[model samples]
Target: MNVAPNNHKTGKEADTASVANYRVDNFTRLVTYSPRFLLMLLILPVLSGLVSVLLPAFGWAPALEQTRFGVQGFMALWQTPGLTQMIGLSVTSGFISTLLAFLMTLMILAAFFNSVWLNRIERLFSPILVIPHAAAAIAVGFLIAPSGMFSRLISPWLSNWELAPQGILPHDAYGISIILGLTLKEMPFLLLMALGVLAQPELGKKLRQQHKVALNLGYYPMTAFFKVVLPNLYPLLRLPLFAILAYASASVEIPLILGPNTPPTLAVAIVQWFNDVDLNLRIKASAGAVLQLVLTAGLLVLWLAGEKLVKVLCNNSITNGRRKYHDKVWQTATIGLTIVILGFVLLALIGLFLWSVAGYWRFPATLPEQFVLLHFQNSFMQMSTPLFNTLTIGFITTLFAITLTLLCLESEQLTTKAISPFTHLIIYLPLIVPSIAFLFGLVWLQQLLNNQTAFLNVAFTHLLFVLPYTFLSLSSSYRRLDPRFANVAASLGATPSKIFFQVKLPQLFAPILIAVALGLAVSFGQYLPTLLAGGGRIATITTEAVTLANGASRRTSAVYAMIQMVLPLIGFALAWILPKYWFKGAKA
Candidate 1:
């Protein structure tokens, strides 16, 4: 070896050694420079939250007196009466709302697939999609309650005489009102998702061409839609469907406002148990959380099965139908449903605005008896701190989520092999799993770290929910980007950073803005993460609305709900306006 190492080596051998060294350095840099590795850095806080929350769920939390594992807490959960009923309510509401939303979405798409009204309907849907679930529930609660504005409007004429407000709709024993409220809130979401799918110019053009061919063969538009187009659209629409299922199943705030109190939905019940001042009851809450998780998983499987069945049936009918029914019944039905949904949305907002300004709005009164601005004034004065806190959290979370997502997209683009499926699994797990389970884990980690920095922890927790959606929205556009420009720029001696800034960034500006707006809306709507991670120290508009809703105080809740609804709409408008003006010099 010593004899060979003397400077007697050939030039060709030296060249081979240099090449091998360069290859090693390149491999090391590639591994170290991955976006997934960068993503891990962003997720450190969430990992801590998950661990913290899990400790308490097990019997490991010292905050509770459970020094050892036992079946005592789970036994208490089983012994609780009406627990079965609560779980049933959660399942029923979740299934029904998702089913109705899907049906309504399909009908609307069948009617307005490429019609003149499509754009108008899409514009209307944007604001509705931004309305927080809690705000929508509270607003619906105010409008449909026994002494609500609807009752007041017809009580004198239809019910006759006016002094007795006996038949009330809010808190109905059957949960019909809850189902209706959830449907109203969820339908717009489904519609938005459908619109996004339909907006794909290539897909739209292909579907339209197919429709024309079918029409020339004497088939009706609805028939063509049900037969030829819907199958293509269903796959694109599944993500939103899963989102609706998850929200409906584990939602706490909406159920608190509209679900039956005697045996509230499982989520509300779990929250009650967790908040029980007794340490032992927390174990029962943990058990209930586990039960909720099981129920959600079961429902998801059922949904997938049902979707498959529907697709098969629809495909069969498309091949078998012999008659041309040009009745446009679907169009009429869709228009009617849209009108009713919009009417309810308008009535809710109007009622909230009126209640916020009323000094006295007693039952059986169509309008407030006396008008005063004091309620609005008071709400604003008290809400300043929470509003600031929410804005700060939302801005930071949105920025962080967008940045992380962009990096991930860049990395995936650079690599040829598919990234880990677990990346998506981890991101979407938060969306489908009960928030309580994840929040519990986060709390345990917080305790272990003994880091009392609540705001940072809370924002990081919100990012867990927000990041998945932001990435999903951005990934499509990012993948669709043409790589030729980057290659050409590189050949021209441009650096990677400069190419991204000068070429890729400009093209993605619109989708990025939309992603940010969507992220802001998600952050604004968070309830459980904010409450649990903030330790009640951070109150967003959602938290304020939920607290007032618990008391069923129409005036204050209405005011807070209005603010919650408005802030997101503003974000959406910016999403639309900023891109249009910046890119095309016109309004979207």
Candidate 2:
């Protein structure tokens, strides 16, 4: 009997060990396959959104009871007055702004690279990067409009008259004001992206060495950069530039404030169609959205063609061996222009702050005659709903984005296989496609699901955008993580999961926090997605600020814009500080 009892105990121990081993194997497989699963999850909604838009364009949406395909929707869109102008504006503004922003980014970097001013310039632009596009446009309008602050300051004195000059650029029919707004906003982004690209230490050193060789071979500094460094740099920046091109083309808020209204940019027009009281206009809006997508794609193709042509021209120039170009003049001009742009941006922001406090200042005066707290006091109560919605939506979306992004990134690191190029393109699709196009489709989708809560729907839509940017911001840091630390922990008998939680995440606390902050900023600044997906039921600070900009209430508008700008600033400030607090010895 004793021998039989001992045999039973040994059998139970063996069974338990077998089960545990199976579970461990399952988990390892899960970690290895997580990226593909996550990517499929991200792609499904986008594909559905696109299909939903395309169906309506073809006059076949079940929600509106158009069960058969027809071209009626497209017919209506084409027949609309000023459609040509709208597309033209969208195209020109996108291409021109992107071109200028790209050039300015290269020039400024060339001028400041390895200089004492390099770090300082980057830090100074941090706040500029945080400023909301709507707020910037509003502030720019306040300064440059016909009866604007600039006129208030210099008016008749500079003009040798007693009245203000007609605003030359503020709402010019050619969309000049819109271009300026886009260029200013996009420059910081391009610069940030370029700086990120240059982060690899060895790559940086190699480029510097190549630059020296060219200089020694009698190549001008700028020429050497254009010939030697640019070939490598452009490929890295292509994704960001394409994103800029897409954004510039389809932007809603900035163009609405600064662009001409005869036929506003295609994005603005499409938005108006959806917003129209007549619900059938939504079909037309969907059609317009499809056209906008086509237009954007065309512009991208053109950009690629332009790249080829430019490359051929550059090769010829390099072959001619013109080594004595005027690089000093180019450098000085670039630095001077960048400084002026920054100065104007600073002044525009100050104007927003000042207007928020002004009591009743008349035009043609440099400063406010009397400042008061009335605007702030009046705004405090009315701003509650929008502010609440903004906070709730921002938090939820940022949480979702950060969680998903971390999972996919961690899985990629743990996996033996490399993440594919196609996966990278999927990550960028949202940034490249016009939001005005996909967001309306999302609206119809919500209706089909009978989704009533604006807050949830809006947050989900924001997540689509927030994820791409969050992923981009955190990716480089995550990939470049030194594996030696984890290897050391493993040698000490730590399991992979334990090492990841204990060693990897703690070391990466700073980047993780920074990514969250950037995601929050992206979510906070979103206007179109919030406006459309929320169906006007949900209001955020951005929607309110843009609405306020439409009227003659300068002080109240300024208060709203100031409020809009402040939220992101608060998020970024926390990002900058909390990383140091958590990881005391780690760099933020």
Q: CA lDDT, every prediction?
A: 0.78, 0.84
Which pairs of residues have clashing backbones in candidate 1?
A: 49-442, 50-441, 52-441, 52-444, 52-445, 53-440, 53-441, 53-442, 53-444, 54-441
- Report the number of the highest-TM-score candidate: 2
Query: Which lDDT value does model 1 have at 187?
Result: 88
Q: TM-score of every model?
A: 0.88, 0.94
Q: List the residue pairs that clash in candidate 2.
A: 152-364
Alpha-carbon RMSD to native, per candidate: 6.2, 3.4
lDDT of 2 by residue, 411-470 (tens): 876774556888988888888887777777878888789668778889888998899989
Maximum-lDDT candidate: 2
